[model samples]
Target: MSDESSNEAPRTVRLDRELVRALAHPMRNRILGLLRVYGPQTATTLAGRLGVNTGATSYHLRQLAEAGLVIEDDSRGNARDRWWKAAHQGTEFDKAELLDQEPELALGFLHGVGQSYAENIFSFIDAVQTMPADWRDASVLSDYFFHLRADQLDAMMQEVLAVLEKYKTADLTAPLPEGAEQVTVQLQAFPRETR
Candidate 1:
């Protein structure tokens, strides 16, 4: 399950049902999010920040590690102070992957992810709202929508994937231009017509 390939590039992994089930828990998802954004940390530290018992956090962390969604950080000073981080930078799952086995479960998981994203988006908006008017004025808003005829659906998907790959590999941590606020790049695509 480790996708660390030497010859090929790191591939986008699709979470299996068991792994998805493990991540369905709010605490586990939060733990993964924290590790991804802030790098490795011990379960005790995560528990303290999340206001939960270390034992509970440790159990969930173990499940994530077993599911191959996280990997232990052996660089930490002590063996007892186990640290963990996300196994992959990104993950993707198509509807077919879930629908074939359990439609309800897949739908539920997707709904949960959508809800979490919606909440995050609103929270970001609220944070920006509290900032100074001048700061808001300096921000930019962009919207792009277009329709193009394509001979094959696979081609369009490949094009979109290429664009995403560019951003995924880009130096996103670089400092922004003066007077410019953070920019949120959101990409969403769906079939315009069903055959």
Candidate 2:
């Protein structure tokens, strides 16, 4: 399947603990993030951009490829310079599936992901602050809070998932306005209070 088309709803695949462990590395996570954002890239290019040695990058790339997180772009030549892209546009892991067997590990992984995003947001804010006035004026950086009384957790989850699906399927190839650049949009939702 084409990488662009692979962005649709992902299949329900069993996520093994080994796969999660492979993804727990900071460099691998960053590599995945880069593949998702930049389409496809060669290990040499990734190594240069990430300031890591090509050998190390290639090793991690192989690990990710073995775990099915990334796939070689065979359409291009299978030469040493071949590029690799993410196998799936997104990934899903059932928390309940892991919680029963490895509650602590599952929770720890989730917490690390949350912290990574928090750090990323701060870095983005720092970059924004250093941009020219015109750029800052055209940018959007805001936080919103809402409180809702939900009758059922499942229904609430479905609603939020539906919204996310829309954004995930959005057409992003449209031409932007003059001088406009891509901006990161992060959406996070969780139970604020447990009753």
Candidate 3:
């Protein structure tokens, strides 16, 4: 699935406190994830996948749209149906800055983000052995401890994202290779808490 919107700038946007607060709900995170990983879809489709009714998905979709986390795709579906997609493929923020400015709100935001990450990580673990050998070998599923300054970590994070972006198929409209599959590349660069 393509991450970038058809008529917008690249699908990457920085988040502010208000936006983070808006995204604190777990359902919002899951809905956004589904959209990002599968391209634009109608609320009914998402509801079916999520095991929820259309009304529940439609309500959350509206809330997400209000927060700029999602946008309506008028090009898709008929007048009777509305399609929704992620407003951005990714989001970023300075943890220190957020905590310094609004600690509680940042925690709330991070909680939702962290919940999503944990879920994905567990899902990956559960499905890793069932994947093809080549894909399993290509998988990146490890964390390492290292001594580094904050700037150094930031630089490394940028390099990793750069590599991922280089190989990304940003536009869903383009035809991809026969073996092409939408893959989620989840990354985490954070200090390990010590007791």
Ranking by lDDT: 3, 2, 1
lDDT of each residue in 36-99, candidate 2, tens digit only: 7676889998999789999989999999998888888877656558798876565568878877
Worst 10 residues of 3 by lDDT: 1-10
Better structure of 1 and 2 per TM-score: 2
Model 1 poorest 10 in a row by lDDT: 1-10
Each model's C-alpha lDDT?
0.71, 0.73, 0.83
Candidate 1, residues 74-187, lDDT tens digits: the string is: 677495688887776556777787778777777777776776666666766777778788866765444455565555556777888798667553323345567754455555
Candidate order by TM-score, decreasing, is 3, 2, 1
Clashes of each: 0, 0, 0
Q: What's the lDDT for residue 184 in model 1?
A: 50
Tens digit of lDDT per residue, candidate 3, span 98-184?
A: 899889888987888888888888988999989999888888887788989899998999899899878887664345679976676
TM-score of each: 0.67, 0.70, 0.82
Alpha-carbon deviation at 12 in model 1, angstroms:
3.0
Worst 10 residues of 2 by lDDT: 167-176
TM-score top scorer: 3
Comparing 2 and 3 by TM-score, which wins? 3
